[model samples]
Target: MKNLKALLAVPAAFGAVLAVSGNAVAAESLVEENLVESVAVESVAVEAADTVEAADVMVAEPIQLAQVTSVSELSDVRASDWAFTALQRLVEEYGCLEGYPDRTFRGNRAMTRYEFAAGLNACLDVVIQLIGGGDLTDVRRLQEEFAAELATIRGRTDLLEADVAELEANQFSTTTKLRGQVDAHLVVPFGEADGEVPLLDDDGNQATDPDGTPLTTRDTLEEADATFEYRARLNFDTSFTGEDRLRLRLQASDSASSLVNAGGLASQSGRRNGFEDNIGLDDVYYSFPIGNRISGIIAANSIVTDDFVTSTIVPYDGPAVADVSGPVFYDQFAGGNFGAGVNFAFTDNLVLDLGYSSEASNVNTDDGGIFEEYSYIAQLNFLTDGLFNAAVTYIDGESDELDTPDYTIAGLLNLDFGRVEVGGHYAYSPSDDGDQDSYGLGVTVPDLFGAGNQLGLYGTILPDDEDEPLVVEAYYQLGLNEYFSITPAVIYADNDSGDDSENIYGALRATFNF
Candidate 1:
């Protein structure tokens, strides 16, 4: 009876989760090999067992069977999960389930061999009982099909139980999980990818001849071989209340941007494909639910343009799109700010957003500090039945003109047509030095050549005092695997920066995600 108690207890420890993972089969097979010898020993002891007490074999505590409505109700299991099919059958037909006191099944928790065996044993008995009741359509057949596995599952439940007991006594952390993303990119620039252009200095003062000849030239394009760039980000998401999240993002990068050579309009890495050296805290933000339909964000470091904006007009905003592939009409907005913002859901498909950011918040003096280089943005977003989406935004910011302020009014829209998505944005800048307009149209064809393959074409017209430059770009994104992709793009520009500098750009970008 004592030996029987150990055997049954061993199986109870292993239980049902392992059944879905298929580890139970391996465990059962191992146990069956040992069972061949154990059963022989047991048969010889059966004559002595008749004199032994049945009390030694009975479990001290009753087995608790869970009342599960659906496999999706299990926190670790979901209808859309990869393990759904195997788990569904285990719950619906076997009726062998056990859950925590709270009713949630932590199916992802690891288990020892004994626990696996125990779970299998529980299911085996339920099936056996169903077969006897005559309602089991294939339970009997399945039981015979896995007879060896059943014996194995019952076989070394002891060792697994002991191992698990020891581990539980030494476990760590009921809260907190760590995740990370490392992205590596290879950017190759060709054709007329390097050149110099004119622009205002960081102080907002024109670094040019008063006669308009030119006081300075920014070499927008660099003449060099292909460059490799990489950025690594580690995010720590902590939650006290399940509905609130505090995120600390730490990042490091050693890459340079090729905005000019890549047919990019601005000198921003936001459009390019690299990062600066040294690790730094990129963002520190907290989000909490204000209500069922409202949420808010407060980020101290690395405030950005889209943090407050409700929707994006561009579809494929990703790495390597910096030069010619990204949303050109959105060039005037985004990046470099510190702020707090909120998103409001007026309905299921309508959202409103508001945010404020400061570029030089850390600088404090009579020079204005937090209010000196600040911006305020407001947005309204609307979507229609997964077919079309649009956004209207108004952004106000400090101007380089000392006393004056600058603002932009923009509209963006996206339309989905089966395998293709079309999107564009229009922005109008009102400034005394230059009143300008920018607009772009783009199309995305997913699965163009194969699964995960995408082809994109975009045309953009950017405002340039006297010259409106037109840029037409094309690119194809090829997925190599789950963690890697290759993007090859071509860009053609007419009247580059209003200088009539016509050029062609070819770029190959490869990204690896880890």
Candidate 2:
């Protein structure tokens, strides 16, 4: 059957090839025939401008003729070239190229309008191709569909093309001038659980509790204590001169109601609170280029880290046996206060970041009050085929409760393939006698459903001491379209305590970006 199909395709393929060749030859012949002829057409004569040179030339006719004629009529003919006419028209139509004066229009000198419309058109042509427009045929088809518009600019196609080129020249600066992104998600949990269990995933999915039990919306375990299951993140960044920049990041999440009992560990939410209220930062900072290879950041209140940050879509901290500065422990290390730092890029692929944080006792709350700690943080980051990062931080001074830990260390590594990403992190708090370790693996399949959408899978696991607890969670995102996605996830927790308790929770989420 395969051989028959191959044999049958041979004639059709050959015939198609021959037809394409014929079309190509026909096109080449037509193009040659349609070439603009350089015929000695009648010129649009004009009187010489009133100038002293005209008088001198009139008097020294022999000298003037010798000078002008030696330059050949063709060379002098440049004074009447079509390019000059196009430029003159451009000035008359668009005013002075934005930042120039009328007197600045130098027609006598050879100029490259390639930075104008011509350049813009060429760059756009490339962009349209990169964005999956296929090939030149697609562009021609679009032009054909908009034939009237194409026809209107046909006479000045070269100028129009240069316009795109000009835009392209500015595209880098323009895109770098100021940029912003918004990430928001609304997830609904639909798993069945008898009571509140620890959600295996900390990412805001209202899954089961740490104990092996299911959580539901109904009355059985409705009043369990937990942060809201919904999470939202918004960030904006602006870069000036492609170097110095400013950034503002915000994380917000809704509260969850769930109960969990692991060993002697138990948490019951008196009321549901958002993730932001529990473990996130609301910060703004300004970054300025310090030297040729260094930048400085001035932040009053910010979230600063030395490691590659994973998504807050989950509720658990990263896996670092000794996470000294983790949210679960510090809750607000370099956050909820003021701080500053410097980042140095020793090489194109290596970076060193150091920052100092001081608290004026602003983050005052019942959980942790007026933390009057001084945080010193440093991190060394390297990137080659993938990324390797290590960070160390020390907290001096005392919590309002006078229980500030001395130091924390964290390490992380990430390997990214075209569509797959795998990463792990470890955090340790030698002073507090607490440690955390976490790892995650995820993959994104592109163009699902033939709609240029994507499908993604993410899973992570975190395990602590014998009675400390273990968590596992997984999710799948099905792209509904270019700007929308539907994600469903599950979280499971097993409490190895006397009850050998387990809990499960599930969520269905929708996300949109602009």
Candidate 3:
């Protein structure tokens, strides 16, 4: 029978080599008695192959070691010495010494003969259950002195159990997580392109054509051509208490904005264009947390007020486009599609926010639900830890189909410096038929020609009640890595009238993330 258990483990390997040679002669140096005789001879050769097995062996679940009852609770073991009384008698009389669930006992580095044979097979399974049946002859003489570190820790624990069973069989959710993005674009439009510019409305006036002539921009850039457009999204996000989040997203688009058919040259590159290309559910939030300086959100569908601000301290609000990205009176008075919001934090650089949206919160008659066509907001952020920030908003919309109720007021700013930044914005709404406004200013720069490159430069005036055109833009981007990017851009517009107004455009975009 295996040579009669190797001749009855030669008197239990001569009583574990005389109890590790009396704890390495009560160690006090010779390098802690050669580190307790090289961790009890590499832990009796990992418990002499614990009764050998193998075919499909996995073996990984190990860390749960806290046992230590005084090697002075090992925070780097000490007590004036080399192996303090042999780790306080193998940690208080055979408790099988342990430490390192951060209780650390990393006695000055270097271990790894497969972590000293997994700490000597956990002190030989607590000294073979405190000496009741031992005779593996010091685990076959430390399994012939560490048989190649226990076969390289069982072939790296069977290749980490076959890479954790192929990542739990190709995991795609254990509480959601998707994320995506696309973009594309192309656009063109160049200076007046052949005159006839007129057709304006949405309060920029001049719209005629019912035989009444005047509706032109050369027939809307000869029927809006030179295009390409695209968009895509995905998101998903979910979480169930890692401090909340939910999201949803999904989307698709046609993404127009080749100067939005000319007339006063509309452009925010058509602000994420019209989803007429299908795939829906554009957003449906949830966000959470409410004690530790508040936080909240509840969207139910595309909402916006910069998603309850905490900083709109613009920076071309994410690369720019014609309307200098934001503050067209907060997208004409704060967004909608249902909403709710919060944000408190009064410090760590201030915050306050608040929100409410509803372009018919899912509509339901009586002039449609949720306070009919609403919008509300409030802001105040500030933030800083260097690189300045700012905010200040207020809104209050209403629109029984525009029967009036506007009120707006906005502000934002940013600064940076360390390769430029500077941003700015301003809005104003006030309508009794005429007091709208908008503003912008930008600069960016950022690693200009390399590292996630960028460039930008802007100017604006856009929100009008009559003649506010004036735009200007420029772009660069060019990331090309962590999932792509391109950009290009250039715009111009004018419409201060006085003869051939003005126009120009050109774009490129490209993007892609995942």
Question: Using Cα atoms with residue i matched to residue i, what is each candidate's TM-score against the true structure?
Answer: 0.60, 0.47, 0.26
- Candidate 3: stretches off by over 4 Å: 1-133, 136-183, 186-220, 229-257, 260-325, 328-347, 351-380, 383-390, 393-409, 412-436, 439-461, 465-510
Tens-digit lDDT track of model 3 for 1-514: 5445344433443322222212211121233334454556556665345312211122232334445677677677678876577666666655555555556565655443344444455565555654445645665777899999999999999999999999888999888889898877687877553345444332233435445554444443534457777767889998998889898887766533356433222222222222236577868989898998988888876676566877678776666644336555655643556789889997788888898877566556565787766777899888885788888888786764342337878788888887888888888776777876778888888878798787878777866677677777788888889898888888777757555556677877787888
Q: Poorest 10 consecutive residues of model 3 by lDDT?
A: 20-29
lDDT of 1: 0.60
Please report the candidate that would top TM-score against the real structure: 1
Per-residue alpha-carbon lDDT of model 1 for 251-362, expressed as tens digits? 7765344334234421122211222465777778887889899999887777765656656757755533543344433334333436788989999889999887765556
| Candidate number of the best lDDT | 3
Give each model's whole-structure lDDT. 0.60, 0.41, 0.64
Clash count of each predicted structure: 13, 67, 2
RMSD of candidates 1 onward, in order: 17.7, 19.3, 23.2
Q: Tell me how far the alpha carbon of residue 222 in candidate 3 is from the true structure, in angstroms, after superposition.
A: 3.9
Clashing pairs for predicted structure model 3, backbone only:
43-120, 365-368
Poorly placed runs, candidate 1 (over 4 Å) = 1-145, 151-177, 183-185, 193-195, 198-224, 255-257, 261-276, 323-337, 362-367, 401-405, 449-451, 495-500
Mark the regions of model 2 whose C-alpha exceeds 4 Å error after superposition: 1-151, 154-242, 248-253, 256-281, 302-334, 361-371, 386-405, 417-419, 432-466, 478-482, 499-501
